[model samples]
Target: MTAPAIRTGRAGPEGGSRRLILDMAARLLRSGGYHQTSLREIAEAVGIRKASLYHHFASKEELVEAVVNDGVRFVDEAVAAALAAAAQAGPRQRLEAAIAAHLAALHGHGDYTSAAIKVFTFGSGPVPESVRLSRRLYEDVWRGLLAELREAGGIAPGRSPEALRLFLLGALNGSIDWYRPERFDIAALSREFAALVAPNGVDAAK
Candidate 1:
């Protein structure tokens, strides 16, 4: 059976109070590590009583899972858009465009990216297998793009596409920790990153 569909956009009340709780939980998870974040804090952040928080999420672990699931959904959408664009363009152009799209999503959706990084890098205890699988699917999106680029000769011939993919992914994903829009724009940075890894090794136009 297919996995349950991950929720996106503004989850309405049909998603119920649980949706509100998850939103607040996601924010807290972004600002603080899982251990540092508390249900009480999430409730307060939502302007609800601590007891009411349980009505939505049973425990901290459950809340964390929701946060991860939500984040994965956000990333999936971004990657999907990039892939769609890549399909219509040459490898080099597509890679550059895809990187720009990814960077735009990351910089524009700071809270989502922050929560995703926290869950992926340092979650408390063992995460549920479902959550792990969701994260894997998220990573696979980039891997697929990199593979397509390599097969199309967009990437250099001698380099390991897998290694280059990992490096690019690491740099792109790690931007969540230090990226500041005020200091540098997303498009410029995306171009710079793409140029650094381009097969010709030439700097991308500013």
Candidate 2:
């Protein structure tokens, strides 16, 4: 299958300014979550009039949708690359690559990526549909990987891949609350989590 589209800077009239708005929006969303972030704040940070910000996005929800899509696309691409590179590796290695990619994608890609974890919730707003769609898209990718591990007996006998999926995502996503980049990096978390879920205490087949 073709790869997911990786996010890049936009180009057009006032494209640079628009990108700045999105970047600030992402940062505020990451720091304060959905309800706390406001379009006015985003505009002020972008050094544009509120009306000018509206030139790029009609509503706050619209701007947020773009940010969420960008975040999902990034991790989607990162995980795809990790999985592809591990094509010849064992299922355990594949899972390791996936875990590492996930951690790397979450924290290091700025607020666009981190904001995803922070503001990700279903709500009665323009964002709910987009939120669900973006999440399902990313989840489906990881689900495929877990299914393979399940088929190979790389998952525990009593546990299902779906459960593992929830566990892994929940754990990784919660890092926004306390993850200290100075103290721990994605590689370390990846290895630690990989060990935790290593199929009934075994990393791989003997």
Candidate 3:
């Protein structure tokens, strides 16, 4: 896929400069893991100096946090929207919609997803509590959905909602390691994953 268009200048009509830096940083993080990404490189990508870049972000760690936080927020919002949209739909429909929305966000927000996953699964050292909390919030959103499905008798009663929630999340998030949107559309892949976790092959049609 073509690289996302890069914008420049100091916060344009819609606060563009700050967004440009974040976008550049996110792209860099996606192409090269967090360890290899640097503020200087982000600045250079935005056609600015490293010193000027610090004007927006206090340090590399801060920038990393910002990128991660933004990603988490984006995901949280997507989940909320999906759940709201699928409120009237059946459990399987809700779950599929939620998963598809998440995958789309991950695909479009590649940089944030890459950084968030890297920091979450294999961080170098102690991450800021805020980062951990943000990750938890994202997980909780999924767990909440699973709980709703359980209440609706969508999943088998014998299985723990928490366990099933983890299973679903593990399967969905694991896609980042291997998923190529060009090869598999979000809807088709999410449906396949949802079916894998459905109890007793419930609603295979979904």
TM-score of each: 0.82, 0.85, 0.85
Q: For residues 104-171, write the lDDT of model 3, one tens digit per residue.
A: 77876456776676555556777788888988888888887788677666777688878888777776
TM-score of candidate 3 against the unseen true structure: 0.85
Q: Over the stretch 137-190, how does candidate 2's per-residue lDDT look in tens digits?
A: 899988888787777777778886788889888898888777888988788788
Candidate 1 C-alpha lDDT tens digits along 87-204 = 6566566677777776776667546656867766744577788878987887787777678767665677788877887888788878877888899887788778877777563223
What ordering of candidates by TM-score runs from best to worst?
2, 3, 1
Report lDDT (CA) for all predictions.
Answer: 0.73, 0.78, 0.77
Highest lDDT scorer: 2
Model 2, runs deviating above 4 Å: 1-14, 122-127, 200-206
Model 1 gets an lDDT of: 0.73
Clashing pairs in 2: none
TM-score of candidate 2 relative to the true fold: 0.85
Model 3 lowest lDDT segment of ten? 197-206
